[model samples]
Target: MSGTELMEKPAAPAKLGRAIPPAFQGKQFPLLAVIVFLALFPPLIQSDAYDLGLLNNVLIYSLLTLGFYWCFALAGQFTFAVFGMYAVGAYVSVWAARHLGGFWSGLVAAVVVTAAIGALTKLAFARCSEIYFAIATMALGSLIVILFREWTSFTGGYEGVSDIAVPSIFGYQLISGQSKYYLGLGILAVLLLLTVLFFRSPVARDLAFARDKGPVAAVTGLKPVRLQLMGFAVGSGIQGAAGSLYAHGSGFFSVEAFNIDLSLLVLLMLLLGGMVSMYGAIIGAVILVYLPEFLRDASKYAEVIYALAILVIIVAFPRGIAGLRHTLGRLVRRA
Candidate 1:
């Protein structure tokens, strides 16, 4: 146990900046694989425009789930108002498209406005934590849904906004399902990259410390409130962007589409994926999105079947589908 012997390990290399664990970093390979598969999928497998369109929806929902994961897993907040932000982004984008000329402006406006709203929500609930914060955010989401229903002129009230412009840039409209699918996939891929980068950034470290260490983090100079607000902003902005893309791509925007149920669905997606990491978000989204379709022929039992599957996942794999492989490996080693 001499000094030289003890120092031979080299202090674990003093990791200077944030970085994702090697296990999590490996997710990038699968993500890239999925992208390549998607590129070839339409022509080789799907071959149907409707199927491609369905996948585009899945991509949008994946973005929504990923955004929620950023807030819940990274920032350690339980806010569920992302649905509100999503709706606001949808309405804002559509409105902007009608008045401001095109999709780019609408997207820009949606992100900015939704981010501002997220920050404001954080400010208002700065003192609340855990369940209280969850309730307040849920309430805020409820209010947003009501506003969409009541604001006839702006939101189209119960009828919802229709005839949403096709997503375009500089007057070039993406009218085909294949075109829209690629566009949405590209946006999702970019967001996924950004999320990965965020996970490896100093801000992520700060937020992780604030969420897991709380008082210790505060004493160490991390501003928990400010970091939480930033989480909200980032999460809301991502959701908003997803909403905008969904609306413009589908050529429709409805208030009913954004509700407490949608929030719960997002939450369930995260839970199924595992709240411990971002990869869980993707796993949960893909499974939940496709499972329902597979069970469609089950008719009245679809809901029950889906519920049972989720229950099984929750009971058998508490860490989520993302962590399922690791869990199985551990069990195998133990055996």
Candidate 2:
């Protein structure tokens, strides 16, 4: 072919050519190691129902991360309402299940109701920008918590609602703390898979696009208001689902459990784990959840330490677990 023709046509490859994306290369060993360690965790710990119960609490927080991951990580929308939604879901489900005579219906109702509440709130705040969104959610959450706390007759005041039922999936009920731990672990696995897969879809891309500025999103022919609404509603729904699980798991529900502190804890989970990376959420969940256990008699102090660690990590290693790994790699090289 002539030079012009050859250049225009494109050159042929050799006899064989192959392409592989190394970014998707296997990290099977690291994953396997993590799984093995977690699987052996109960054995390494006290193994009694009390300690296992505490660990189950950690798993519940992990589930909370899975919910916040949608709003905090994927969509970059921060809401202080997540824990409120979580409480709403838990109590609603328990109450519904007890009254409705089945756990299935309660679970469905919990999510639906929480979503409705979240949708209304998001629509109300759709006009606001980022900091405003957080402030609005915080204010709404505080209001909700107060309602639950002061609406004594219904929510049982500071004492919480007790004797609530634990859930049974396909007739296999969680009879003990260890059993509940395994069940929570299973549900968590399902949620992780769904979030990771969902992250690659157009829906996720649309949400991310809309997060920058509402006007920009409007100009792009995207409904920023509606997108934020959907994310807020869905994220709240997930929190509710986690709440449902927690209510049954703990056999109780209280305003204190799902108050603003829990909201900050969720945020910490996002930051410590690196909100952009799914692994970051999981890492943050594990650290924050277990740190209290290691604290023993002075767990409140451990929380202070955890907060300090989070600030340091955010300032020094914004990339999360992946970032820390990169830093360690450089240090190893220098050494």
Candidate 3:
């Protein structure tokens, strides 16, 4: 073929066959399926308030873990400020709701304030090494926890803030366990959808490049610092939202709820689930949350067994449970 003709020629059509829809491709189908299951779950166990509460916890922790995934996993920013952001979000939401006269206002205030704080924190430590940045954020988080503990007039000290306003929509209060569970599930579904979209977008690719090849990315016109700052802000904002959800749903919370232990537990969840996988965050949160309950009968051995189980999982599947599928597929192909 002539050069110009070849350049202008349309590609030959392939044989016609069924094509998978975009929604069913990659991880989208599985995410949709999970959402569907969660949507139906409340009706299946509506009578069990305890189980519903546990489900709510799963949803909440999933959000928190996803935030960690965004910052540490996606953007390569090691930060221990998750719980601090969570506490700030919760307290801010409560304060806003009391003064601003609505749950929506409080939630908005939480997300905005935490996002700003997150961005500022990143900017302030923009030049620090990863380890130092982590240390700085951790110290700041601990300081926040201490502030909340000592601020009796604000956080209610050790007693925590009580009589938190119930979250409502259009005059309808989410008073029942089922209602609260569905609310959390809906928020999670929306965020998961956004995350999926983000994963498919060019921005995610650029962020990944920046994270894995910082100096090279900067040399090639990618703004690594800006990307990391945005990631940190968004991630922190998500944590803040989770915190607001927790405060409103529980109607009471203390600084103890957002201590350093909570931050470490979240980090463990992220590590155990597979840092790079968004689904891993959800899987990790669910497993870790339920594992303790399952081992409740073990009593004295529970802690030991828990530690052993985590160690085995980490050692055997370093990439996490979500990565297990990929390993299995590789083995199948090799076989």
**Backbone clashes counted, model 3:** 0
lDDT of 3 by residue, 1-335 (tens): 11011112344444386553322235464756665585666646556878888888988998899888878887789889898999999999999998999888999999999999999999999999999999999999999889999999999978989979898988999999888887888787777777776665557667777887889999999999999888889889999999999999997788888877877888899878876467777788889989999999988899999999999989888778877865667778999
lDDT for each candidate structure:
0.76, 0.71, 0.82
Q: How do these models rank on lDDT, best leading? A: 3, 1, 2
For model 2, state the Cα shift of residue 50 in Å: 2.9
Residue 125 error, candidate 2, Å: 0.4
lDDT of 1 at 69: 76
TM-score of each: 0.87, 0.80, 0.89
Residue 74's lDDT in candidate 3:
75
TM-score of model number 1: 0.87
Q: What is candidate 1's lDDT per residue for 1-335, written digit by digit as tens?
A: 11011112123322567543432333454655565465546534675877877777777878888778767776677887978888988999998988998888888888888889888988998888689989999999889888888998998877877878788756778988777877877777777767666654557667766877888989998898888789878888888898898889877666878877788888898889876556566677778788988998997999999889999999899878766766798889999
lDDT of 3 at 121: 96
Name the TM-score of candidate 2.
0.80
